[model samples]
Target: MAFLAWSVCAHPHATGLLPETRLKFRPPPNSLFAVLLRSPWWVSLLIAAVLGLVAAALLPEAFRVVGALSGFPFIVIAAIAAQRQWRLPSAARVQQTQEAVSAMAWPAFQALLTDGLRRSGIEVQPAPAGDAVDFVMERQGLRTLVSARRWKSARLGVEPLRALQAARQADNTTADVPRAVCICLGGFSDTAADYARAHGITLWQASELALAMRGVTLPAPKPAR
Candidate 1:
C-alpha cells in the first residue's frame, strides 16, 4: 500500500495533487550535479528527504522535527550551485578579455607616439630600425630625428643622446643644422636635460610636448612658384 501510494503521489500524471507535489519528480536544470543526479525531480526530493531523515534521526525523539527540515536547505544548495555554474563561463570570458588588452600594451603605446607626432604638424619619417622611434620631425627647415618613450621608470641616459648626436653628425646636413630630440613620456634626468641643453639639442618631456601640440594646426603647403 505504501509503495502504491508513493508511486501515485510521485507520478507526473497524478490527479488532484498540489503543483509542488507534482514538481517533486521533475528534472533540475542542466548542471554538473544535476547531470550526476540525472536532473530528476525525484532524485532531488529523495536527496532532500534523506537529509531531513538523517537530521531527524540524529535528534532526540522530542526534537525529531530538525531532520524533517533538511529539504529546504538541500534545494537552496542546489539552486546556488546551478547559479554559480551558469556564471563561471562569463567570469572566464572577462578574464580572457583583460589578458588581450594587456597583450596590446606595446602596440597601443606605439600608435599613441606616432599619432601624437603626426597630429602636431611634424613630418615624420619611417624608422630604419625597430618601432621604437615615434617619428622624425622637422621644424624651421631643420631635419630633426624624433622618438617617444612612455614609461614610468624611464630615464634619458647618455648613451641614447650620444647615438642621436652620432647619427645626426653622420647625416648629410650642413654643420649648422641642429641635432634631433628624444621625447620622453615622463620627465628626464636633471643631468640628461642639462647635457642636452648644453649641446643645443631639445629635450621634450610629456608636459612640453602637450604644450607644443596644443591648439596648433598645420595647413597644407602651397605649391612653389
Candidate 2:
C-alpha cells in the first residue's frame, strides 16, 4: 500500500544543497496512467468490480460466483491502501514541517533542529565558544559533537570538518566523547565527502535536514578513518 500511491509530486525544483548538482525524478509522459499505475491496489479493486459488472451483463446464469469471488483478491489490497491513505495526513504534516525547515534562516533552523532532536530523546546544548562545533548532544551515556553549517550550495571544502575532528580528538582525552558529526545545510564537496567517508564521520546534509528535523531517522554517519 505504501507503493500504491504517488511518491514525489513534481514541482519547481528547490535551491539544491549542491551548488553544482541537480537532482531529478522524472515521471512518465502519460500522467493519468502513471497515477493509476501508482495506485495498484485501487486498480485491482476496480478490475474486480468491472469483472463482476461484465458477468452480470453477459452471464446472468453464472454471475453469483463471479460476484462473490471477483472482489476477494483485492480485499487485502484495499485494506492496505486504506491504511496508507489514512497515514497520508501525517505524512503531509511531516512534509510541511520539512518545507518550513528548508526555508528557515540559519538561527531558526538550528533552533528547530535542536528541538526536534530533543523530541527524539536526545538532550542537546550549545557548544563552547570557539569550539568549532555547534551542538553537544547526550543520550544514554553517549555524547556526540555536531557541527551545523549553512551555505547556499555545499561547494565548501573540508578544513572546517578537519578542525572539528581535531576538537573531538582533543576532548577524547578529558571527556566521554565517542563520536562527532557534521551537518552541512549545503552539500559537501568531493574532498569533504571522501574525507568523511574514509574517516567515519557522520554527515547530515541539506536535503535530509527537513525530514530529520521532523524526527525521521537521521542518515548513517560515515565510517571513521
Candidate 3:
C-alpha cells in the first residue's frame, strides 16, 4: 500500500481530481489571549512562575509564605515545560516545523498531515495529484487545500496562495472551497496577510499550529487591504 501510494504521488500530473463541495465558513472570534491559549501551555505557567519568583524576592515574611505557596505549582510546571521543549524536533534539523513537512516523502507527509487533521477532528480524503497542493480537508461540506512548508521565499507573498486559489477554482468541484496554509516558521508580508484575509484563506502560524492540529476554530484575520 505504501509503495502504491508513493507511485501515485510521485507523478502528480497523472492524478488530477477535484476536492469536494465547499460551504461558506468563518473562523471563530480570536484575541491575543485566544491565540495564546493554543500556544504551548507552558508559556502561561512560565509567566506565573516569574510572578511567583518576584513575590518570593520582595514580600515580607508573613506574606512571603503566601508567595512561596503560590509559586510552588508554577515552578513545577516550568520544569515540565522544559522537558517538553526538549522533546520537540531539533530546531537545527527542523529549520522550521514546516521544513519537516517539506522534507518528508510524499507518503509520510500525507500521513502526518492526515493524522494531525484527524486529531483535530477534520475529515481528510485522498485526492489525485495530492502532492501538488498537499491534500484536501473537509468539514461541514466545506473543502480546503491543506498544505505546509511549500514556500521557498523568506517572506511569503500572495502569489503562491493565489495560485492555489486559482487551482481550486479551476477544478470547481465546488466554488467556495478555501485554502488553509500553514506558516510554521516564517513570517508573511502585510500584503500576503491582507490577501489571505480578503480571500478568506486560513493561515496557521507558530503555536497556532497546535490550535489547527486540534481543529480549533480559527479567528478571521483582517489585515488592512
Instruction: Highest lDDT: give the candidate number.
Output: 2
Better of 2 and 3 by TM-score: 2
Taken over the whole model, the C-alpha lDDT of each candidate is 0.49, 0.58, 0.51
Ranking by TM-score: 2, 3, 1
lDDT of 3 by residue, 10-110 (tens): 11010111211111232243943334334575775777767777887899867976775665544443544454454343443343445444445556645
RMSD of each: 26.7, 13.1, 15.3
Give the distance in Å from residue 219's predicted Cα in candidate 1 to where it truly belongs.
Answer: 26
Model 3 vs. true fold: TM? 0.45
Q: Which ten residues in a row have the lowest lDDT in candidate 3?
A: 7-16
> Tens-digit lDDT track for model 1 on 14-72?
11110112234334558534463334345555677787888777888766675576466
User: What is the C-alpha local distance difference test score of candidate 2?
Assistant: 0.58
Q: What range of 10 consecutive residues in model 1 has the weakest lDDT sum?
A: 12-21
Tens-digit lDDT string for candidate 2 (3-97): 33433332211211111111144446475433443484577678667777776776767566756565554554454454444423355555565
**Residue 11, candidate 1: C-alpha displacement in angstroms:** 92
- Model 1: lDDT equals 0.49
True lDDT of residue 10, candidate 1: 28
Top candidate when judged by TM-score against the true structure: 2
